[model samples]
Target: MKIAASLRAGVMATAVVALATFQPTPVAAQQASPQQTVRVGIHGADIGSLDPHMSAQTIDNVIHAWIYGGLVRFPAGTIDPTRIEPDIAESWTKSPDGLVWTFVLRPGVKFHGGYGEVTADDVVHSLKRAGDPKTSTFASDFASFDKVEAVDPRTVRITLKTPVPSLLGLVTAQRGGYVVSRKADQEAAGQYTAKAIGTGPFQLEEYRSKQFVALVANPDYFRGRPKVDRVVYRFIPANESRDLAFRAGELDLFYGRKEQRWVDRMKATPGLAIEVFGPGELRLINLNTSMKPFDDIRVRRAVAHAINRADFVKFVGADVVSPNPSVVPLGYLGYTDQVERFAYDPEKSKQLLKEAGHPNGITIKVLGSNRSFVEPYQLLQAQLAKAGITMELQLVEHTAWHAQIRQNLSAMVVYTAARFPVADIFLTQFFHSASAPGKPTAVTNFSHCDVADREIDAARIEQDPKRQLELWHAAQQKIVANVCAVPLFDEDQVWGRSTKLEFGHKLEASISFGPMLTEQTVLK
Candidate 1:
């Protein structure tokens, strides 16, 4: 989500005062007053539900951190390849057979309302709920287990049907696995869609759709209460409007990257700061390989060579978005830089189109949404036109675009996937041949390419880390060589904050709002 840049000075001052008095806490004489409220600006419409099981978008994941707790977490001060840290599960061990895994839970961790202590039952129930097809969770991929048994109050053993080397990494994913309360699950199964109950540091106080969602610190949380008393996430979909709010001081934080103009403006304004991180995500056009025209590798390659990536990055105002050779990005383990990428040549693209039996011309529709992707979509349209490919741009609302893409109704659609700490998650989730085309399942094989079934299968069951990496790299090479999907550029997760908000650089794949928020963040 991108933060808008139109904050006004007077409004910012007023908002700052409100935040200053939000939550009062005792501190040393040298410490400044604790920040009571932190107003966050999000760039999309409110998510329909807060249930971690059902959310698939990045924005939804941001809210999930506040309402839910995972078995493990990517702690602050880590980067690119995130290191796992203990959360609810204090520590865990794997058996020699590689089938049974046991976890030692943190003692005295209680649920909301001072309910019973967190236990093995909660773990079993959460995993079972995630694997259930009716629950709509991506966790089904990792939860296809033989059995989940509670050996004791604080101990749980999970037996897997097959060896999964990346199981822990999967569990750490934002959407995959979260330990939900068994008591709450049974009592609120039907009503849990809108309500959330977890052991995280924050509790959801209120949710106002398309307006804002409020979260208060959980005083009884196993980890101490958050430094900030309350966090208010406001959903502002328009960029210009959001920028206005940021400048006006109606917002304490804005979820956007620094454009040149924004960088200049913020530099001149005191108390406001702009920060830039590496491009850890990719913005690309996914062609439905299951359909015509795209079924031909030459056609796909032609489309890749048609557009100018450099120009697109400049238009988008991002820092370095070059053409990627493979779906697996750089900095990933087993990432091979050996694959060949198509160079920009509109003339060559036209010739390839003619050779592919499109002697006259190829008419195709590019599908996209209007919220955070409008700028990139416009840039793509302009570039594609120069290649002599008659393009029909279909601009739809976010909901409609998601529906159309799932149904495989578009010839091509603009999509972005965040950087996964492990490459297996990206490979198995998105490119696996067996993944169903248009559904809410974790299978991201959106292009509907069926050529890599055997390769993906081989990689999934390979227990040896080095061997699995080799197989995955081989699969990525095959996809790239065929131009199955055209990659545009990597996107950085950007946010704007007050100068007082001090935090370390986030890990490349880090998704948490701000790493410093986890007990480590302190007010200057």
Candidate 2:
């Protein structure tokens, strides 16, 4: 159901009644032990898609990670790809020329639904599917791949157009890396988004539109069966409603609120543990330069100077959120002091506005989602108003907001994202003109800044790691100079879990969605 953004209060009241009536599944009761099921509450109203290759949103990637396996994977509960280990691929070897990579598949890894053991052919098909633009929004992530060939029943070789130092890291990431079963994809065909069968420890059991998604442990999983017999992700869009369900014991874990007061409140709640870690999401405001008004750099810079970062950081706790110094956030490489060039000066803002022929200031309409984006934008609206600029917000459902932004409808776009690890990934996806909206292979270039396109393209194939970073930093500086987008802050990833729950690895940080549920995650 599409809940109106303005109807959150009404929905919260009805949601409580509905949640109170929610019964524990039979699978939980059937288990002899208490550690049978884990129910989680998240902020999204629904999953956009579950197909491993198709789903690019963090909400969807979180679910996909559980049901899919990649050739190589980041260590459990971690985000850095440098520490990656073998998954479906037992091991791999690189050619002396550094252009060819050969991977050896694990002998007995089996796909769900009796599709039988995963083979080299499946790997070839999966990579090819990921590279196909029509099938995956992140197909560009694999643009370096020239060919993927199955050398034998157990070996697959991937040839690259150029040696990408971050190739392994890219292949181990959630987007283009996760392997999907060829047999399952073929069987599902038009129904792939709803159905998924992979080599992971959990199998998709049931998916209820706009409500919840249920998964059951895979008994024949290669590593071992998941300790929890069932996992249920309930879609609770309202922050207050999610907190309510979590406090009432309907949810064992839930996504935490970003506001300072809410975090403190949850921290005081007994029997609850809050985990906040980063290099997290970089929350940014993308001013549509392709459209009128924002098309002018002076207007874009005016919008930037009118806002107060100190107020924003203070509002959302300074402990949890930090100032983003560049388009490339703090924790990532290639981040520089380029952001210092734009300071929070309302006087400068008005001057720029005057010079641009808007002495009385201008009003811009912005579209955003209610869950997380709206709160920040509302604060921004108030901040901008102080500088004589008006920010008019039109709120919509999260999914609809995403659809609208991609169509370039909003004058100003509010987005928070955990980008791909490498600097090139962020530059190409967000700054390259080829990936901008309205382009043939557009993905997330919401700002439509094309000046850095040449540098971003050059950085993608730069072999020297240090020089690659330098190029990435230069490209970012260009974006900053153009005032294409305002880098607000990078907030820590926060989640509240029951003290009784244990995810085998340390939940210190993750680049994926949340602390992932591997075969070892279990309820105490």
Candidate 3:
């Protein structure tokens, strides 16, 4: 599980050209070819973990979604989360006050490895595990839940401490909402990853370290058996190796590099296509408010004015990314243009710095990862230099960077994420005082911006969608006014696929997981 140190640019460039110029095999030859398996060459050395509640990495999430089933789920074959469809739970009803939610479990759905039928007890256990801070990464999301009870073998009841309008939407999530067999989990002890059991369309067959993860079609899947018999996700650490594999027809699909030049080359390649989609990564610059110079709002504002987001976007690739005006993305319900306040103005930044008693400007040391975060922050350094501010980047390993940032060590933090499905989840996790750097429910709020806490809480229990959006929008305005963060862009994800594979739905911009690869995905 190591990142590739180098990519053979010359070899990959030649491979891309050769693939683009080459002709496809004859239809007769293609028709006779066996296509029962879909092999994907992914850009990763290894996965962190397969435990759905524990792992938060993109690669892990993709694998978990294929092997897990939630009580309720988003639309099949699509990642758009605007609709909620029944999965393990056939139907559900909520009380008028929204305090109680009861779900009727579907019958005849069995967990993998002969664990027995999934019932209300399994659902209750799974949800309780997710709510426990010791076991789940999404404990904060379910903090309002008072208790969960199994009314009967097929009925489960959830009682909340307060009414949450977005409770149903939250339960449909893949991360914390997945239901695991309680018996299987206990018997496996700590070996749950090896004997992963779920009622999904696919079952984990093999997980070879630094090689690949293979899954076979679940014949007893409640929905229906998958069209493809097997799905393989291969780990190719080097970019050139993945490109070479795709060109040689050894791999059916792979994640594309986030560069327009790479995308253009792939698009020209014969028998290959690029899929670009979003509500993508919300790129933002987090300023530690408790830190030295940034303790003053003027300093934060100056830093915000110093950044030219368009310049940063150019380096990341405009074809696959767009500017995001607020913490929330455009496709979501509570998105607003509040971030437009900090338009690129170096003069204003210099003036603000002078007023803040730093006429010569300040040099801030930033701690960031050597991967995606470094390049953008490096570009940001040059941008800030225009206003006489010097940005010194301290390169650290990805895990160390995450750990250090949570300790409030960085002057500014650069992060890119396709966050939760709803605005409340995003707002609460990132801006609430409860989620501040050292709080009990601390997560990603490195900025320690607690001004929007009231508005965020108000939105959580608004009940009316229209009024809820207003509350969320007001919170965004407050964040901007305080200059807690400088949003760079909302990036689109790019993937390369062979012509032989056809996903039943359009490649969806997913926030919960990666591209949809469900029962309907097939090999042509």
Tens-digit per-residue lDDT, 344-380, candidate 1: 8988888888899986658887677765567666666
lDDT of 2 by residue, 260-292 (tens): 777777766656777776546778888899888
Residue-level lDDT tens digits of model 3 in 1-524? 01111122212211111111112543343234354777777776887777777777777887888889988887753445567789999999999888999999999999987888998999998999888878788887898999999999999999999887568766774888888989987887867787778888889888888878888889889878888877778788677888877787667778777766677666666667677766577878888888889999999989888888877777777787787778776566677885546888999999999999999989999888865655566678888999878998899977677789888889988887766557787778777788788787886858588899999999888888889889999999898788788888777777777766777766565544356677888876
Q: TM-scores across all candidates?
A: 0.88, 0.91, 0.91
lDDT of all predictions, in order shown? 0.67, 0.77, 0.77
Q: Give all candidate RMSDs, comma-separated.
A: 4.9, 5.7, 6.1
Weakest 10 consecutive residues of candidate 3 by summed lDDT = 1-10
Candidates 1 and 3 compared: the better one by TM-score is 3
Model 1: how far residue 166 lies from native, Å: 1.7
**Model 2: lowest-lDDT 10 consecutive positions:** 1-10
The 10-residue segment of model 1 with minimum total lDDT is 21-30
| Over 4 Å off, model 2 | 1-35, 96-98, 338-340
